[model samples]
Target: MAIKFTPIPTTTAESWRNGGTDAHGQKPERRISDGRAPCRHCLKNVPEGDAVLLGAYKPFDAAGAFTETGPIFICEKPCKRFQGGTNEVPPVIAQRDQFLIRGYSADEKIDYRTGQIAKVSDLVSQAEKIFALEDVSFIHVRSAAYSCFTTRIDRAR
Candidate 1:
């Protein structure tokens, strides 16, 4: 299976940024970057001087215990969506020493044995190894240090 790195969709991000609501359907919590969070839309760190939104987000559309709503960062203003090459590690992942990668089943439940902390440099191959399995439906890349949702990786159609 060919892998594709997917960032948060721009439309959803725009709705949240424009104050439609967060995943919780409440106004998104806004804050200034302290240098740790990255805007999932752009797949880039929210530079120290910029504004950002801190809000709960569910990576999967499925609504169950496995559907987690965790804190995620987004630009206070709109930015271009990440368009990194397929199977390539985005700058957000590549700039870090390591990040967490984990697989999920078709039902969106976590696949226990597929979770691993991957070196940024080796991320693509690591993802390929996991996707090689028939049971794996999709994978998520998260900030290893804090385990926040970064993006999803899916097999290219």
Candidate 2:
């Protein structure tokens, strides 16, 4: 099966750059990259000298146990959104040592026993295995240490 890696939605990203409030409806903190920040749109590291907006992100609509705010870094300047392709891991994630991947059900609820902290080398196989499960609606990639939102994954159409 093919896989799709999705970044934060473009509109949401634009809001952050346009000086609009974040998902929490508060102005995001403007900051420079420590060079570790993964700009969701480009799915690449924002260079050390690049600008970014650090703010809270909840990757879902309905507020519930599964829905909670966490930090995410976005480009301070507008850029194209990532359109995930098959057989490729974005550089931002590929360069990392480990990541947290979790499965969600059709209703967008977390699927039990479906989360794993995977090594970068194992991400592809791990994501493939998760997608093989029929009950999993989608998957989310996050920082294993900080659990910060990174990106979303789905079966590629």
Candidate 3:
């Protein structure tokens, strides 16, 4: 199955400019390094010999008063989209890490419905269950620890 990874929205730049803070007003700045950190998209730590750029990204579409976005880097080398299913949920997802997965209702509202997957391994099963719901349109996987978004998955129409 081919899954298209959505590009981080431009609004994230503003969020970054505002100090890379989330809705909770917590600021999580990138490590100040002469070098670069890993690109979350490609799951690769940036090599010290390569170049990196500071950019803002909104993992989600802007629609509310408290929407969040942040700063990230664009790798010189393009990264491939993640194609793995449950098997590739990532080890980080399951290590007692607090995360949030929101499932949208049909009306495009918050749905007041959300799932908390403590670990990465639980994400796939939780996502599968959420996707199975007829009313859910998509899901926003976020890190509750830092309130940063990991990724968004739109149900296949």
Per-residue lDDT tens digits for candidate 2, residues 64-157, read 8888688888888887777656858998998999999999987789887789999989887888899888999889999999888899988888
* lDDT winner between candidates 1 and 2: 2
Best by TM-score: 2
TM, every model: 0.93, 0.95, 0.57
Clashing pairs in 1: none
Q: After aligning candidate 2 to the native by TM-score, how far in Å is the CA of 115 from where it should be? A: 1.0
Residue 119 in candidate 2 has what lDDT?
Answer: 96
CA-lDDT, candidates in order: 0.86, 0.87, 0.52
Best by lDDT: 2
Q: lDDT by residue for model 1 over 1-157, one digit each (tens)? A: 4678899999889999777787888888889897767889898888897899888888897799878778888998888998776677777777789889999999998888899999888888888899888799999998888888999998877
Candidate 2's TM-score: 0.95
RMSD of 1: 1.4
**Whose lDDT is higher: candidate 2's or candidate 3's?**
2
Q: After superposition, how far is residue 35 of candidate 1 from its true place, in Å?
A: 3.9
Q: What is the lDDT of residue 117 in candidate 1?
A: 96
